[model samples]
Each structure stands twice: as structure tokens, then as C-alpha cells.
Target: MRLSNTLLALGLTAVEATQFWHNTGTKSGWDAYTHEHKGTVDEVTDQVYKGSTALRMTQIHDSSYSGRYHSEAVKFNAYKKGDTGFYGFAFRLQDNWQFSPAQGYNLAQFITDFSDLNCGEDYMPSTMVWIDGDQLATRVKYGEVCPTDQQKIKSFDGLKKVTAGVWHRVEIQASWKSDNTGFFKLWYDGEKVVEAYNLPTNVGDGRPFQFRVGLYANAWHDHGYEGTQGTRQVWYDQIAAGDAFADAAPDKW
Candidate 1:
């Protein structure tokens, strides 16, 4: 009986070691999602994005995965052409990221794509702070649909350029300003890219919109949209919801 118990202990230790070896580089610390998404595993990457027990995305279909994380940062279309929601994260979107057309309420998003044409639009009352490969800039638009034609509420060009392949912090803070007014702000690498302010009239107060994060890959008008077609890998951790929008730091862990 003692021999059998010893063998079981050894087996358990071996399993743990194997798990640690696989997660060594990619994992920094445990996020609340790790425990909430306990059993689900990604079949592609074998990584998991677990949520807190109380706030699990289990209710949303196609919300979770059981494979490896995305290989390339691609375009994400969580809301349908007419759907609306809120989402925020710090990530790297290679030049290849693509944005879908603004059909109804659709907003195409691309990070790290510094070119003026490539940077897509967020919803009205939304703010995006992005570091182009060359410099840092914030895109704040106030209207629904593509706001490229509208005046930019705020723009910053003095920010430093964001290096590729390196991890940088980015975040978006959105709140309701009034029954039909919305406010949003953006930050890059702990610096404010856009200040707090009101959103566009068309967006009609951002209060009701929830947030979603994912990757999307779609063909672009020009075959030149090569980067937009492929999958891009992204790592997301320490996602939270509250009034105060702060970046996650090692000290906080």
C-alpha cells in the first residue's frame, strides 16, 4: 500500500512539472479568469483565459476557446454590422491587422498600424490611444459610423513611438456623461493618449454598451491587405471593470 501511495505522489509531481514547463514563458501571473474558466482549454494554443467565478463569459456563445492563442493580431468583429458593445485591452496589433467595414454600428479596430488609412474607427463616445511605429497618437471621434470625415476632438503627436514585438500597455475608459452623452479616454504605456471628454451625438451616451475582446481576420478591398488576412497572436491579462481604469503592474500582483 505504501509503495502504491509513493507512485501516485510521483505521478502527480511529474504532471505538475510538465504543466510548469509549458507555461513558463507565456504566463506571468494568474489572472482572475484562470480560476473561473477552470476546465476549458484551448485546443489550438492549449492556453486558457479563465474568468472570475462570478464573471464568466460562459453565457456568450463562441466567447471562449480551447486551443492556442492567436498567432497574429487580426481584426475582431464582436458586434455585427449593427451591434454595439464596449471592450478594452493592452495589446500589440501588427501592421497586418484589418478592420471591417462600418455597416450599421460596426467599428473596425487596428493597433500598432501607424498609417493614417489603416487606423480604424471606434464607436462614437470612444477613445483609442495608439503608438504608431514612429510616434504616439490618440484618436478621439464623436460620431457613429466612420468618423474619418468628422473633426477629431483630440489628437496628440508628441508621444514616443511604440516598438514592435515589445509589450506595451494600452487601455480605454468609457462612461456615461448624460442620458445621451458618452465620455471616453485612452492611454498608452501608462501615459494618457487622450483626455476625458464627451463623445459624439450619434453614439448617444455609452452607458448601455458592454465590452468584448477578440480577433477578426477578413479580406480587404485591395489584395494589398495581406497582413489583415492572417491570424495574429495576442496576450491578454488582468482584465477588470470599474470606474477607475488603471494598468496592471507587477507590484499589484
Candidate 2:
């Protein structure tokens, strides 16, 4: 919803995003959605952050299977080169979530397709927010999107504590620059955890990137699933994004 000058001052308004918001009560808000084999996406009322419903994303481990696990909702054109914005959401891990210090569980990411190149990763992700065990981690990807592009990945880990079974907030503000002039920052549970600046924040490929959230058991596909908790679930609510921090702040808007 674009807030008019009056609304911007009065803190009221209309439309979609200059502002965008989703209660995760239904599938109607996302630009695209997916749930791979054995993974399920549902709207339930058992737990919520702000509204009556929340999205439940679940993935089950397959010891004998070799496919990736993902149940996600995508917001297309979330950002591109030179665009600056704020994105935020509320999430909760299942009560019995098992944390493996050696493995990672990705929660959100910004990505774009580079199939036109055909020499490197097809769908390259620019920035990703995740948890390695109970600690928060994030990173930036830059350089040309090609086979010999250096694949520069600058990672920032051990940012914050991620607790299970309770609702937590996440907010990211980024300047989408493919050169060493961009900045990226993250806030966890209302606390500023990561502050980065003057760094290349994306690939040389200037394609529009999609913002995706939910459960992506990427480690299972790359490092193999860990422990016995084969089936894992996560809940998300109060998803939002826009040009200003308050427009996307989970608690503000």
C-alpha cells in the first residue's frame, strides 16, 4: 500500500507496497509458490504473529532420495541493481526442531535466473539468511554470473541466537548494487545484528531477483540430512516489504 504524504505523516493509507503485506493466511499474495516432493505448505491457525493465520512450511528427509527439499513462496521483482528496500517477516521453528551445528537451514533468500549464461549456476541467489545450528548467518554474492566469475561470496556468520518454538522477527535493508557501493543490514528479534557497507551486493547479472521465504533444506541436498528429525516444520507470518523501514518492519506496519 502506497502511503500518501498525509498517510506517511499520519501513519495511515492504501494500495499494495510502496508497501506490501501478507498475513500468510492464503496463497493469493505470493507471485509464485512451490512445494517439492514430501514437502507441504499449509495455512493454519495454531500459531500466528499478527493475523489469524500463518503459513506452515514442512520438509521431510529422504535417506534414499536425492532430491532437494523446499516449500516456499516467492515475491518477484523484489529488487534489482540500484534498488534499495526493506523486507521483513516473522517466523517460528517447530517446538521440537533439532539444531545441527554442522548443518544449515535456510530461511530466506533473494535470487535470479541466469540460465541465459549457461556457463555457471543456473539460478543464482544473491543474498541468503539462514541458521547454522542456533546461530544466524547471512551472505552476499557478487561478480559476473559466469563459469569463471570468481563467484565471490562474502559471508557473515554468528550474528544472533535463533530460538525454536517461539515467534521471532527478521528485517533486512539492502542497497542492490553490483559494485562495491552497496550496503546490507539485518535485525533479529528487534536487535540489530549485522551491519555491512561499501560491498558488492549482487552478481554482475542485473536481472530482477525474487525474494523467497519458507523452509529450504538446502544442506540436505548438499551435505546430507543430519540427525533423526526427518520431518521439520516452520511457520511464517506478517510478511512485508517496501521503500521505507517502517513500511516493512514486522511490528511497525
Candidate 3:
């Protein structure tokens, strides 16, 4: 029996199991997380999913850059073509979150720099998760990155309502392909919310996309901030990515 167990352990290491990357947000540095925001990005121990720390992103209304307040954490070069990956994260909105009419608050995304193309678009995002008021939404972008108007965006709205002061899990499994053979799936709080097959989910060009998760007050930049809450905050923890569902699931890792 001892010999059999030894063989099994060796076999398990031969194949890559679910988790490829995981972050409990307990680290002191931001070496694994990158973002371009002049706002607050820090680690707090007041709340978390499974560890002693959680990443807190706070965005306040700024009149400096025409209401552009972005406080997000990104994992650069997270995905490429022909790669199937599952991403999972736990997030919590502030208890004082104000839910007004429809407004956009981006949560997570897969983006990359497209400035070399000289196509009027500098940075392009292929997949994104956001909140429309208190409702959760996501989308998958198709077509090439150029002109700023040629890309095809397939949006899935009203997945689940965001409950303030609570923890929610979001998981997405996607097949990155420039062709029409790719697929996209999303799960919210252990429930499958999105399933689409035979669809192109990325740009045709061969480039890696960076995955980001945080609070982007885009509505303030787009619609000029209509909500009553000026200071917005969100906590993120147990972020992971991998080839299998268990690898990225919150409870599994």
C-alpha cells in the first residue's frame, strides 16, 4: 500500500492540476497585481474570503481627469490564444453602496495594449465583468482591435444582483480563440449564469491579454456620476486562475 500511494503521488505531479495561480491578497507587495490608478490600493485584514487579508480598492470622484477614477488590480499576460482558463474571485461591495439607476461599475476584465496597431484604439479589453446598478453583467468582445468601432461586443446583462456588505464569488471559464470555435461560460456564487458555444472570444491577432479585477467607477467618467455615493470601495480575495474548475474555485484552493 505504501508503494501504491507513492506512485499515485508521482502521477498527480505529472499532470497540472486545477490551480495555476492563486492570490489571497495577504501579501505586502503588488508584484503580482498591476494597475494604473492614482487611487487607493491596499491590503486590509478586516474582511476576507479564506485568508487573513483581502485587497481593497477605493475610488473617489475626481475632477482632475474628467471624472476618471480607476482603482483595479491586474495580472498581466494572463491568457493567450488556444488557451482555456478558468478565473475565480471573491468580492464584496461596500455596505453603504448606493444603487441608483443603470450605471456601469466594471469589476474584472481581460485587456491588453493595442497601441502598436495605430488603429485609434490604445488599450483593448476582450472580456469584462461589470455592474449595472445593483445587477451584475459581463461581455465577450470579438473581431479585431481597430477604429474603435469595428469590434463586436456580446453583452450578458442581469446575471445576479449585487448585495452590499456580503461576499460573492464569480468564476468564468473561457476558450480563447480568434476563430469561431471558442466558447464562454460564467458562474456566480456556484450557479452557472452564462453559457455560449461556438463563438469567437478574442481578437484575431496573436497577443496575450492581461486579467484585471477591481473597482472602476466608469459611470462617473461616462455619465458624470449621478449616484449619491462619491467614495466607493470593494474588497477582493481568493483570486485564482487555472485549467480546471477546481483549480480556480474558492473552496478548492
Please report the candidate that would top TM-score against the real structure: 2
Per-residue lDDT value at 226 in model 2: 78
The number of residue pairs in model 1 that clash at the backbone is: 25
lDDT (Cα, tens digit) per residue for candidate 2, span 1-253: 2223442332222235567444444565566777998998888889988868888999988888898888988877677888888888889999999999888989999988878777857777889999999999999988877765578999999998888999999999988888989999989888988889999888877778888889999999999777878998999887877777776677775
lDDT of 2: 0.81
Of candidates 3 and 2, the better by lDDT: 2
Rank the models by TM-score, top first: 2, 3, 1
Evaluated against the true structure, the overall lDDT of model 3 is 0.78
Candidate 3 deviant stretches above 4 angstroms = 1-16, 27-38
Cα-based TM-score, every candidate: 0.40, 0.91, 0.89
lDDT of the candidates, in the order given = 0.31, 0.81, 0.78
Residue-level lDDT for 182 in candidate 1: 51
